[model samples]
Target: MPALEHVQPLEHRSGRTNVPGAHGFLGRLRRRRAQREHEASVICFANALRGMFRDACAGIGLCQYVSVAAGITVRTPRVAEVRLGPPTSFTVELMAGQEPADFTSKDRGPRLAHTLGAHGLRVEPVAGRWVRIHLLDADPLRDGFGLPSLAVATGAESVILGRTEDATTLGHAIADPAHLGVQGQNGSGKSAFCYGLLAQLAAAPDVLVTGSDITGLLLGRAWDGTAHRAHQVVGTQDIAAHAVLLEDLVAEMDRRLETIPPRRDTIRPSPATPIVLVVLEEFPGLLRAADALPKPKRGEGIPVGDRIRTAVLRLLSEGRKAAFRVLMLAQRFEATAVGGGYARDQFALRLSFRVPADSLEMLHGADARPLGQEHANAAPGVAYLSGLGRDCERIRVPYLGEYGEYVDRVQRFGRRAES
Candidate 1:
């Protein structure tokens, strides 16, 4: 038998030898084949997504007869572009001339998501007649995320609430001084959200954090002996102390407003006069407790509840210029519960988490009624945020870990309070 001649490896122009499984001719061919397969698979997925979207629109009663304007384009693997068409006979009769608005409304978001059986969806109106449907492949907010370590030198002027559906951090601008309203049912992670927010605020040297908890659970252990703790954190049984806290806030607000220069519309916070964040947990219960207190026997006197309500309203209406921000947490934000519709409107930042229809509407207006039903079973810490110059969008509040870790973070980030 003739001995097999030894074959020298062929070297490609790029100096790579034709070794098996290396980036040579065979490897390039394999990569091209895989690329083609991936492209084909993506095309198939796009077609399927388009079909599902069309069927979803039909199921939601959005139809147009023989119109070129009605079509869905694949924007990405997870998003679809939809063009709005004139309403069909049924839609025209049902929505009259407002069918387009109804089609692109935020309220329709949940229904469209359900119809498509998507993980989560947000409908964003693109110029005239176009809307983008963002489909979440996996819920980014399903598992709570931890707070990012912020630079202490930067000084957190805004509190980082959580992450948005787009995986961007959602922050509430406290530096500009807008009152915030947070409402949710019990066990809705409302307290967790509060803790996260308070932790950030307490860490800011230019912020003075004071809070009252009707349950006495929120403000006690985590804040008691921390250097971040500023003013007294009133507890549940102290209805009179609640009144006193509000009154003191109002007095401070008045003092700041009086001292503001005529040329300036708002006060800038500093170590000398830090922004006052008055957090009232279970605010409605506090109001009720104040109302239950007996009237002064000396003469005609305002009930403690009325006094607290008046003080809160004054703060909401006039606090912005004075650098006093209120964060009111409650199960409901009805006009009566929050003093009135005017008071509710003053909260430029509103967050509703797993609340009832009435409560959602109270926070986001009547348009949010449909969303309330859609989010009736939203996960804890999931909430709708409104009044930041954008349509209300869903968000997930940051989880601060266990109680021990939360308290430790609070202490770690907290600055010593100025005398």
Candidate 2:
């Protein structure tokens, strides 16, 4: 008999096929390699940013040392997020220790940007002893993005204007009824900003939108036939009509004031008594037009210009409690243009778009004077907003799409007046 062929089992006794453990081992190796590479890349980037920040602090005379604690996070290709160790003082010889506030001074912002090879930087203090820094290698607002969906609900007291440099939504409290002063040059995206704001105001059931535009350029088609259109927008070259409109608003404010309970400080808006937003477009032109009008006969009460100025001043001074708000737009907010410094001071919210240094200072004060040229050259819709208990911030107003789209949005969200 031939030797029996060595018989081999069809399956391995271990009940395992292929290369046991090879696949899992290889997978583990690959994961370990990938994690190492990622960590190495993070270290490399962190080191690079550390060097940039080191040099920047030195140039700015900040004796405080900064450390990258949270590592590097890339928000966009051009933007990076990092957390820095709280500024701590260093002493050399007999030098006194400096405070962290010295390192975070507003005056040092531009200098810090220059030293960091960055277009812009936001230094925000976070919890504990860390400062969050958003480093921008390029302007995030150089190009316009579509407006974010409105987060405010119908009858909400706030309105979303646009976004800040860090892409945070910027909103204003309309319920509190503070006046807004908007200053920008021609073709500076002011009209677009106004349209974006008006769309939201019109959507709110407890807010009534009324506007006066001497050039008729801003207050036209979008508001013409909507029930959301309250108080028939003044959209013509008639200065007399503008004055009358403002006077009527003052009268309405007075009526609302009387309805407030003695103990309550303000009138809470309801469908029956909504907050009235008076938008004055080409505000300076309105004043100039009024000035150009012939004086009334000796017995005619007050000149149209005086009536306009007085009504505006009264509204600015007394409208907040009565739920009356003003949004005044002008090329320049000179004392003469807005009825003097006293009147200008009443604007609780001030926004300056692309304008000259003098105009920026006029709107935001001397600190803004240094940024005039920067403002003048800013991209359309870029502006500096200050007031409402917040420090001045650079923001890009929302782009509500093309003219037709904007009008459509205005009409679609418009809340009809209650019957």
Poorest 10 consecutive residues by lDDT, candidate 2: 86-95
* Residue 55 lDDT, candidate 2, scale 0-100: 68
Candidate 2 C-alpha lDDT tens digits along 1-419: 11212323223345555744434556456546766897787667666766666666666766433455776422211123433322211111211453334443557767777676666665555444444555566776887867754634544556777687768887776886578999888988888888888877767767787757776645656775666455744544566888888899999989888888888999888867877888889888888888898998899778999999999899989998888888899888999998888989999899988898888887788777657777789888999999868778788888877888677776677766556
For model 1, the run of ten residues with the poorest summed lDDT = 85-94
Model 2 lDDT at residue 67: 50
Candidate 1: clashing pairs of residues:
none
Error of 1 at 63 (Å): 5.0
Taken over the whole model, the C-alpha lDDT of each candidate is 0.70, 0.72
The C-alpha TM-scores of every prediction are 0.75, 0.77
User: What local lDDT does model 2 show for residue 197?
Assistant: 82
- For all predictions, the C-alpha RMSD in Å is 8.9, 10.6
Supply candidate 1's per-residue lDDT for 215: 77
Best candidate per lDDT, number?
2
lDDT of 1 by residue, 1-419 (tens): 01211222234545776557745567556666766897787667666666776676666656544435666532212234332211100111222233334544675555666565655554445544444555554666788888765513322356687788778887765776578899888888888887787776666667777767777556656675554354655565668877887888899889999999888988888867877778888898888878778887767777888888899999999998887888899888888988888998898888989987777876788878777775667798999998778788788988776767667766676666445
Model 2 pairs in collision: none
